[model samples]
Target: MPKVIAQIYPSLGGTSEMSRHRPIGRDPYAFHTVMHGLRQIAQAMDELGYWGLSHVEHHFHSEGVEVSPDPGLWNLYLGQYTKRLRHGQFGYVLPARDPLRLAEEIAMIDHMLEGRLFVGVARGYQSRWVDVLGQRIGVRASSPGDRAGERRNKELFFEHFRIMKLAWEKDLLQYRSRHYEVPFPFESGIADWPAAGLTREFGVPGEVDDDGALRGVSVVPSPFQDPHPPLFQPFSQSRTTVAWAARNGLIPITTFAPIETAGWFAGLYRDEAARAGRDYALGQNMGLVRSFSIHRSRSAAQDAIERYEMLAWREWYGSFGHLGGFRFPGEEGQVPRPGEDVAARLQQVGLIIGGTVDDVKRQLDVQLSAVPFEYLVWHLPYAVMPLGETLDQLELFAHEVMPEFGMTPPEPPRLRVPESSRERPETRASEG
Candidate 1:
């Protein structure tokens, strides 16, 4: 059965009433609402037998949407409330962060969660925050078009990704890339370091040279999982990204791509993995991201989709030209214009599945059977959907639709009493 991960958008209050409040993202009440809703959803997912739960990382959402700034901290907060449900981001914007700092934080989070952690990385597209945060490194955000910008962003992403891997897997790191140099000034290294002697004595070997200069640095607190946790890369569409992920053993989660397009990427991933000496079946290490709404009737499901998803699609994502990628197989041309029915277009492409339990099962059957994806990332618009409705949808899917795909709720864990802690029958009788 494919593992199902719930990816929440974490949009601060955008309800009709709350929308009146300017910049709801900054509103204390809205913030409280989102936090409370997240806790409820986490508990529901844990009890519903979700394989994992994740959130996105975006910033500067003064308009009160997609306000998840610190995904690592959010994951840590949610992980404390649930047992069994793994936590992660859908992913962190790599170019906007210091790779070494990110590595250290994720490692600490992994230990805090007791290994119930997975990681995802992304080449950021949001200029609002990415450009500002990455300014220190001379990095800029880019999209599908701008060839020059995209090239630079890809280079930075690859370099930072490598640095993070080195920090996780090795005892000490000495890296030199276009954007970074470990121990600063790779040729001369850090000279006259106060802790050089102590680092050499207590830290990993080769951290300091004979002259008491820091040569290599060790990233402390390696991940709880050996060699780091499972890595994922979301929104993968290009062959270059897919191939790189295959070579690096990262799961590529494709979103907005039609089934045929996704299958083509899956084939490329399989071929690339084979070339990299890690044989994988088609779709074995790939994932698909899709939005869904389930209800008793198809029309009700459509209403749910409209109430929960359409505003964000039309106003937020559409403005960025993201809706352009929602084309169906063999249906070529521009996406719906400003006044067109974006929801209809999404349904036509099967990107947004909505209907009764049977209806949803049939829709998913078509896609999952077509590509045998090992992971299904279920995108939930929790910011707009009411808590009760959201829980109902999750319960319906977990109990009804998921079973059609051979998925079932896991058995409740049994608490085992240690032999030394158990009471003896003779001692109990004497006490009585």
Candidate 2:
């Protein structure tokens, strides 16, 4: 049996903010707001039996975009506030970053969490970010064949990870690379310009190594998870990414592939895993995530689904620049317009289970039996849904729906990141 895991996203729209992706919840998107009543929220998940709540590391976006911005702090705060909640963050954009600093933060967090950490890696979704962060542009930007941008992102990520592993394993920091040179660069270039070598051209202050070679400073603070935290990679429409993840040992979290396509996607992972001498667990490398809402009565479920179709999906679904997921139960044109049985739509995706408790139970049993997914991340506080009502819904979920999955809602993930590495670098959004 696959152990069940659940997640909560901290962005206001994460679970608590339902529909307001239109205007900046924070004008200027700064001076963040403090979350209220975490105790109640934690108690609700714990009692109802969820596994974890994850903090996403998303980015800075223009008017028509929304993504998680400050996962570093969000992860820590939410983890500390709730017990049994496992914490997760996919992490700062891999490119345009100092890997040493990233290594330090991940290590610290894992130690603090006492082994309850799930770390994911991604090249970021934005193409322009390469130019913004002083990287070469026009790599894989035009088409799938032109995957220069993504390939570069993957290269930098793997190189940094190699160094990160070294930092975690060895106490003596000495690795020689084009990026991080050792033997103390400052010591090597004595007769001419000291350790400050050609690095100045790239804007990095050069230093000397003990071996009289021009080198740079070593990254400090290794990671805490032994052999490092579990790595999960993001899934967009990139076939290269999927193949790369399979070659390497990475768990995958995907988007864009709807539920009907889930088995098809699962087949991809399983096939890759087979070639690599590994069996892909249903929820391990492949997680099928969708939105869910459980109402107390069947009538209420019907009403909410009705309201969702007529009022919610059209206004907010494609508003934030998302192209799909607009069709709701009973809505005129959802993606899998299989038919109008709201119950079937609910059963199909396992996302909005709006029936009475027993009805919810039947729906829950069917979905779980079908997917056995590792994690279930609710979009709580869905657009137009108020926080109070969100809380009430959570309470109802705990009471009526949670038990069907057979999980103990693990402690919220731990707050282990240090003060220095608490802020994630912003990854821009997709123009599409």
| Tens-digit per-residue lDDT, 1-432, candidate 1 | 788998887776456735587768788888887898899899888988888889889988887778788988888999999988889998988877889999999999998888888899998998888888888877788765778777888888888899999999888899986579997989899998898778888787888889988888889788888788789999887888899999999999988777888998999999999999999988998899888898888999988888899878888888988888876667767877556698988888788888988889899999999999999998888777777888888888898887778764433333334354476766788999
Clashing pairs in 1: none
lDDT of 2 by residue, 208-288 (tens): 433434444444444555567767675433455666676677766655444445444556766777788887665456665
Using all chains and alpha carbons, the TM-scores for the candidates as numbered come to 0.92, 0.67
Off by over 4 Å in 1: 144-147, 337-340, 408-432
Give the top-scoring candidate (TM-score): 1
Every candidate's lDDT: 0.85, 0.53
lDDT of 2: 0.53
State the displacement of the C-alpha of residue 41, model 1, in Å, after optimal TM-score superposition: 0.7
Specify the highest-lDDT model's number. Answer: 1
Clashes in each model (backbone N, CA, C under 3 Å)? Answer: 0, 47
**Candidate 2: TM-score?**
0.67
